[model samples]
Target: MPDPSTLTPVDRSGGVRMADVSQKSDSARTAVAFGRIHLGEEAFQRVRDHDINKGDVLTTAQIAGIMGAKETSKLIPLCHDVMINGVEVDFTFNEEKEAIDIRAFTKSFGVTGVEMEALTAVSVAALTIYDMCKSVTKDIRIGDVHLRAKTGGQSGNWKSEVSAEEPAQN
Candidate 1:
């Protein structure tokens, strides 16, 4: 007989499965994720001046990010359909790096953490920026997608080790 106790995210039958959180107590969970989209000079200028033909690029991306966060379970396999309590997408234009930094904060009171939701938000926001600005420049690049911080759950609190050497953007 296969030992069910040793199975994790997969059964002895070799089928992927979602983790059962039925026994876990509901708790307040939050996650913060970050990503960056590098835009060419022209595209960056257009985004900064709200000159993109696709409407307000940043605002549109922000909206898309929130929607994405709510739909994370639908997009990613094995993710639980969590009821997100809040989602916030913020952006920072780094002229020095010719990139726009995207940050997503997600909160939920559930059995599972909201890290996937936060990551999905940042990823979708970066993609939306690329889609909106592709007409101006094809040199767009998305990178540095990672979890910046997270709290709650059995893991407790965590934070990224990235240094705070960069100047704050308005």
Candidate 2:
């Protein structure tokens, strides 16, 4: 890993500042992140049965995920205003844990990577789940947000596929 001193901090003045993307080349960058929202059995069933009070959990969360990617700059203090080309979110069930696995894939034709956007997507989606199910289950948690893989940019392609045994928590 590069030394911390060698890397430039975003806010040199102890405030907020966006990255300088001007010198970087525009590439077809893509990143995939995975996260989990640990809903109790009751909450999971409520989502499965389409009985959540606010609305459809999966659909609404999916839309929120996409919107999250687009609006990442507005949320994260130092993230760049990226031009995202695509964003996809998938949710599945973990029978053993009785929870949901959310995977977000984000693509951009820009100078910076969209890993943050991907992570933000998962975060917002999980939050949406908690929001929609709050009435039914107050114990819902949004957890284990991570980047599974990232492609393009100076670092090239990188991947980290966590084992199934080490489940995400939230």
Candidate 3:
């Protein structure tokens, strides 16, 4: 979520506004977000064994994720148009949870932070996975999407303090 304190230009009736990053100095910024798609037994096995007929699920999802990050500003109304420098989307199979763990890392050199990009990356990736595996079963669940960490901007650096809830990913 965008920091509430970073928002500005509240109206008299308490209407919220987007962050005005115009005056903020340009700096190297990065963010990481995570989410998962619970594909159940059959879908999970098919994805893990690379037997899905919709081509390589993970590879296609990764590409879609990067594209989604690039278009974050267009998709979200309050988001600023930041020039993203890099984006990485990765996935891992969780046998115990019958899920695919997704990780998205976004980098930028801009006045605004890229946490929204990172979040869009993971969400789009998870949605892509659901699309790919929906043929096997429509009983997929996407949840637990959250920002793991962010660096740069006025916030400096921040990370999720709930270490125990972090992904068991690389």
Candidate 4:
């Protein structure tokens, strides 16, 4: 026997497999993730004023984020395809830092937590903004993608010690 107690994500054959959540009980789970895209001053103005040629950046990105959350399992290998109960994507324009902050909240009533889904939402939202405004400025940078908090599952609730500071208006 391969010592069931010591079984890891990889089997004896050395192949990666999704974690088996079959034994886990159904529970309400929620996760929040955040990210930001630094768009230079001129580009930021265009986005803030909705003057971008591509269209409404925030609205389009929000929709993309929700879609991304639902499709997380397809994009990330080994992630379970759980039924997401809800997904919310919000954006805040930070004039002081010349960046747009993205926050994604995901909820599920399933065995696995929705942390990955929340993260995917933030990442895709940032990417969508980049894609929409790349013509205006290739200098845009996407950074600070992180999981802010998570609740439920076997581990219970947890929060990140690094708090995100709101950007001040110019």
lDDT of 1 by residue, 1-170 (tens): 56775776787677888888898989999999988899978999989999999999999999999999999999999999999999999999989878899989999999999999999999999999999999999989998888989999988999877747333321
List pairs with backbone clashes in candidate 4. none
* TM-scores, one per candidate: 0.92, 0.89, 0.89, 0.92
Q: List the residue pairs that clash in candidate 2.
A: 141-170, 143-170
| Candidate 2 ranges beyond 4 A from true positions | 1-5, 10-16, 166-170
lDDT of each: 0.91, 0.86, 0.90, 0.91
Tens digits of lDDT, candidate 3, 30-103: 99999989999999999988999999999999999999999999999878998999999988788888998899
* Candidate 4 ranges with C-alpha deviation above 4 Å: 1-7, 164-170
Name the weakest run of 10 consecutive residues (lDDT summed) in model 1.
161-170
User: Which should have the higher TM-score, number 1 or number 2?
Assistant: 1
lDDT at 60, model 3 = 97
Per-residue lDDT of candidate 2, residues 100-150 (tens digit): 899999999989999999999999999988888888878877778889899
Q: How much does candidate 4 score in TM-score?
A: 0.92
lDDT of 4 by residue, 60-82 (tens): 99999999999999999998998
